[model samples]
Target: MAMHTLIKEKGISGINVHDWTVLSHKTSILNSQEIDNATNELGIPIPEMIFGNNFLSIEHKSGFKLEFKALPALAMVDQSSKSSDLIKVSYAREWFEKRSMANQEHITDVVKPYDWTYSTKYNGTNLSTDKSLVFSPTTSESIDIEQLKKPDPILFYDENILFEDELADNGTAVLTTKVRVMPSCFFILLRFFLRVDDVLFRIYDTRIYHRFGTNTVIRECSTRESSYRETRSRIPRSKGGDLSLLLDSNWVSSQLPEKESQVEVLTLSQA
Candidate 1:
């Protein structure tokens, strides 16, 4: 897979800032050739649905940039090992054995050192042409959930999946990125949601918020997890509850039992 040589055609949509542009692109899922190319390059089965051509980026006039793309994100996945993020699902072996015999072509059989869950802790990527522009840890400011809930007029909004898989009907692992632009600011959420039928529920989220007329961006990342039974027992059978709600990433994200968060801030002029 000579991934660097592959060409993809896409059109971008963007919002202009004084010195930079907030841009995003959406494109169709990869084709057979592209899938094989990616799989061979990554040394693992490509995801069931991979939008290799889709991306979101902040491009600056001075060539400073930060971008998110599928391949680089997946590159962060822990290649399964004794010390790695190994498969925690006990029945994973049985599922893989059964899947290998059914002529399933969408995914290839996993060799050793593979994380079947494909849980990636990706927090986006930096493609900054300038080396000095970087996000620095901060304790003074954070993303404002209340401000974002004010019902401001939305100028642009979009959500796209980086990749997803159904774990042979046992559960699901999906990574999705969403962005919303309002009259005053724009917010971005990149989430990885994983559910193992009877084992656990995990959510890793990244929130990036920038209020217009400011040179600073606030990014907060959090991780939440709960045992399957514990998560199920919390359901109250209302709009925000139900056994089926377990499958809803948004719903489950709200119900998770624990959270650990980290915050960082970046100024438009990092130098």
Candidate 2:
């Protein structure tokens, strides 16, 4: 599918709007010779014996938008009966309503859009948290791949989230690499139900774009849009390698929220 369809041409509204998903692919174990062939195909100098090494190549994509909207609540009256819970109802409604009405003036000035891009060689380990740890070029070094260690669960890769905005400047692009072990495998010899023989390498990219006219006072909107494209490449194992690995190269759409509905942006008012 096209990014425009997933994100929509008009765009959505809200302080935070983005789409994230994981793509899985079929894989095969590569020998030294095979690794060289695949490396040449990729056109980039990848680690030798790609499967033997602990680190796996990765690519991840994340995109979102921030939209500010005006919300007006006119003439709100308390209609609750004289019950214990009724006392706070009026106050609560008035507080939120008034706050929403006040935010209409400076929403644009306060919310600025951002993007992130950071990349480096990453160590793959089975840690408690699924968070990415980035290493600068100066500190990039290979570690003993626990994936190659015997018996004790070979964690080929770990799932992680990179909190770039939490620790960097606006419009910064964060790029990171990580790998995960896929349960499926194809053995050239035995061809039995195997473990982490096949793995998927990914590169994730997240970006935030501001919608036009949102910086103005008269406009109000908030929504999320997403689009995805995937390609499946079948790799040669031992024999029967002549068979095509290409499954399908197509984009798919998601069933998110409806397009016509309106979303409200809520915030606390100091006044």
Candidate 3:
């Protein structure tokens, strides 16, 4: 397949932070037996065995292409955190000042090295080496309000409901107000810090939604109904864990569908 470039669009605003530790080349934790133990415990399956020189060719339906190198012994922390007041202000200033520069640079178009992995459903299960990261730059040709959907409650109230007509007409009217629940949205950016033994690596991911988009709004929409529904939690570790390091079938499955369907049919027939 022809290699495609990944572009990250500019003027996209968000916040995230992370720290990571990289493992040394001679780390014992990376031994075959140790990796196998982790995979077995996690119930992960190995799908395609890749060599050191193989490049994962990623193509987006939107006509973008990505090629990246997968590195070993890297750690990543992908999370969102509150930024310092001064840092926030400086970021805003930098954003405005570099808006044009960002547009021209089109960071999304650059293809960087990404560590890739697959989820158990796809029959691949390794933790450290199984996790993959891809840096694709995206462009926003138009404002995507849908991207800003958030899960929060919004309240609106009236300011002038309690004052009499005489008092309201004579001076500034005093009004009573109540909270009105509405939909709201917000965006979150995650910075993954990978820790492999003693070495660290960093990767970034962004989750975005509307400023006033709320869970209520998501529930009301048929398209977002599934999001409101609950499901079994798969996270094994809640603290000090690298979610990005976990296998992601969605990423791999998205890439090689033609072969996957054939394999699925065969498995179903045997079952």
**Cα RMSD for predicted model 2:** 27.8
Worst 10 residues of 2 by lDDT: 186-195
Query: Per-residue lDDT for 119-230 in model 1, tens only?
Result: 7878989787777767889999888889898988766677878888887675888888888777677798999999877667889998888886677878898999877767
Off by over 4 Å in 1: 1-11, 17-19, 83-112, 238-242
Best by TM-score: 1
lDDT of each: 0.75, 0.22, 0.22
Which segments of candidate 3 are over 4 A away from where they belong?
1-138, 141-184, 213-271
| TM-score of candidate 1 against the unseen true structure | 0.82
Would you give me the overall lDDT of model 1? Answer: 0.75
Off by over 4 Å in 2: 1-104, 108-157, 164-179, 183-271
- Give residue 226's error in model 1 in angstroms: 1.1
Decoy 2 TM-score against native = 0.17
Query: What's the count of clashing pairs in each model shown?
Result: 0, 28, 55
